[model samples]
Target: MFCSDDPVQLQLPVLETGFPYGELEELLSFLQSDNPTVSPNNSGSEGSNRTLSSPDDRKRRRMMSNRESARRSRWRKKKHLEDTTNELNQLGAENQELKSQLDYVASRFFAVQAENERLRSECASLSARLSDLHWILLAMQNHINPR
Candidate 1:
C-alpha cells in the first residue's frame, strides 16, 4: 500500500491508451496481486497482522460514506420542511387574528357613523324649532308695543 499526502496521488487514474494510463494499469495490477510476505492463513488474522486493503474494501468504505451523507442530507431536508410548515401555520394564525381585529374596527366605525348621522338630524330639528319660537316671541312683542 502506498500512502501519500496528495489526493491526486492516492486516486487511480482512468485506464486509457495514453502516456500515464499504461503506468497506472501496471501499478493497479501490482496492487491487485497477492502479498508475498503475508500467507493465505495470515490474511484473515486480526489487527496489525491484517493484509493490505484491496480495491473492494476501498469501494465498500466509499459506498458507506456516501450512504451516510445521503441520510444526513435527507434528515436536514425533512427538518427544514417541518420548520417551514410550522412557520406557515403561525403566519396563518396571525393573519386570522389581524382579520378579526379589522372586522371589529370596521363594525365600530359603522356604529360611530350611524350615531353621528342621528346627531346631525337632531341638531337640524332643534335649529328649526328655535327659529319658530323666535318668530313667535317677536310677534308677541309687536302686539304688546304696537311699534
Candidate 2:
C-alpha cells in the first residue's frame, strides 16, 4: 500500500523483520505471563516435594528481594523529597507575603501615631492660647470697672 500522509501512522515504532510473531505479540504475551515458578530448575513431583534449597537459589531470592526493596525505597524517598521541596517553597512564599503585610501595617501604625501626636500638640497649643485670651479679657474688664 502507498504511504498515506497521516501523522499518526508515522510515529509507530519501526519493526525489524525476522522475529517470532513480531515484537508486539511477544511483548504482549510476556506482559500477560504469570509470575515465574519459585523453583525454575527443579522438575519432578519429588523435586516439588523436596525441602532442600540450594545456596544459589537463596542468594538469588535474597538479592532480587533486596534490590526490589531498595528500588522502591529510593523512589519513595524521591517522591518525599519532591513533596518537601514543594511545601517549603509554598511556606517561603507565604512567609514573604506575611512579612510584607507586617511591614505595611507597621508603617501605617507609625503614621497614625505621628498624626495623633501632631493633633495632641495642636490641641494643647489651642488650649493654652484660649486660657491666655480669657486672662487678658478678665484683666481688661477689671481695669475698666474696678471690681
Candidate 3:
C-alpha cells in the first residue's frame, strides 16, 4: 500500500513500464491532498487526515457533485418558469392597452365620419337655396325689361 504522506517514493509496478514516475508522483500528491480547504473534523476521531484513496471515495464525490448539479438545475427551471410567467403577464397588459387604443381610434373615426356626413348634407341644402334665389332674380330682371 502507498502511504499518503510519502507519495514521492511510492511506485506502482503496473505503471513502471510505460508511465513517467514524476507524473505518477504528482498525481498521487494531488489525490492525497484533495479538498484541502475542508478542515478535519474536531471529534477526536481516528483517520482525521483521510484522503480519497479507494474507488468508493471517488464514487461518493461524483454522487455529491451530481446531487448539487440536480439541485441547481431545478432552481434554474423554477426561475425560468417565473420569468416566463412575468413576461406573459406583461404582454397581456400591453395587449389590453393596445386594444383600448384601437377602440378609442375606432370611436374617433366614427365620430368624424358622422360629422362629415352632417356637413355634406348642410352644403347640399345651401346649394339648393342659392339656385332658387338665382331663378327669382332672373324672373324679376325679365319683368322689368319687358322682354
Candidate 4:
C-alpha cells in the first residue's frame, strides 16, 4: 500500500482509450479483459491493504470511478430539475387562484360602490321633498292666521 503523507496530491491525466504511459501491450490486455467486477456502479473501494497494482489496472479503476461519479452527478441534476419544475407548477397554480380571488373582491367592491351612490341619490331626493312640505305648511299657517 502506498500511503502519502503530503497534503498536495499529484494530478494524473485522464485517458479514454490510449495509455498515458507508453505500455501498449498492457493497454491491449486491459482492453481485451472482460472484468464485470469493474462495474461503474460498484461502490466498494479497492481494499486498504491493496498493493501497488500495474498502471493499466490503476487507470481502469480510475476510469470506472469517474464514470460512477458522472452518473451520480447527472442523477442529482435531474432530480433538482424535477423538484424545481414541480415547485414552479405549484406556484403558478397558487398565483392563478390569488388572481381569481382578487377579481372577485374587485367585483364586490364595485357593487358596493354602486349601492352607496344609489342610496346617496335617494337621500337627497327625500330631503328635497321634506323641505318643500315644510314651506307649504308655513304658507298655509300664515294665510289662515292672516299674519
Worst 10 residues of 3 by lDDT: 35-44
Q: Residues 46-147, candidate 1, lDDT per residue (tens digit)?
A: 425333455666675578557656876888899999999999999999999999999999999999999999999999999999999999999999999995
Which one wins on lDDT?
3
Of the candidates shown, which would achieve the greatest TM-score relative to the real structure? 2
Candidate with the larger TM-score of 1 and 2: 2
Off by over 4 Å in 1: 1-58
TM-scores for candidates 1 onward, in order: 0.57, 0.62, 0.60, 0.57
Tens-digit lDDT track for model 3 on 12-86?
465333336675565566655653333343333434434324466688668855765687688889999999999
Tens digit per residue, CA lDDT, model 4, 1-147: 223333333344555643345554454444445332333443445532233344657787689668757876888899999999999999999999999999999999999999999999999999999999999999999999994
Off by over 4 Å in 4: 1-54
lDDT of 1: 0.69
- The candidate with the higher TM-score, 2 or 3, is 2
Query: Which residue pairs in model 2 clash with each other?
Result: none
Please list the C-alpha lDDT of all candidates, in the order they appear. 0.69, 0.68, 0.70, 0.69
Candidate 2, residues 66-124, lDDT tens digits: the string is 76568768888999999999999999999999999999999999999999999999999
Q: How far in Å is the alpha carbon of 115 misplaced in model 2?
A: 0.5
Positional deviation of residue 137's Cα in model 3 after best superposition, in angstroms: 2.1
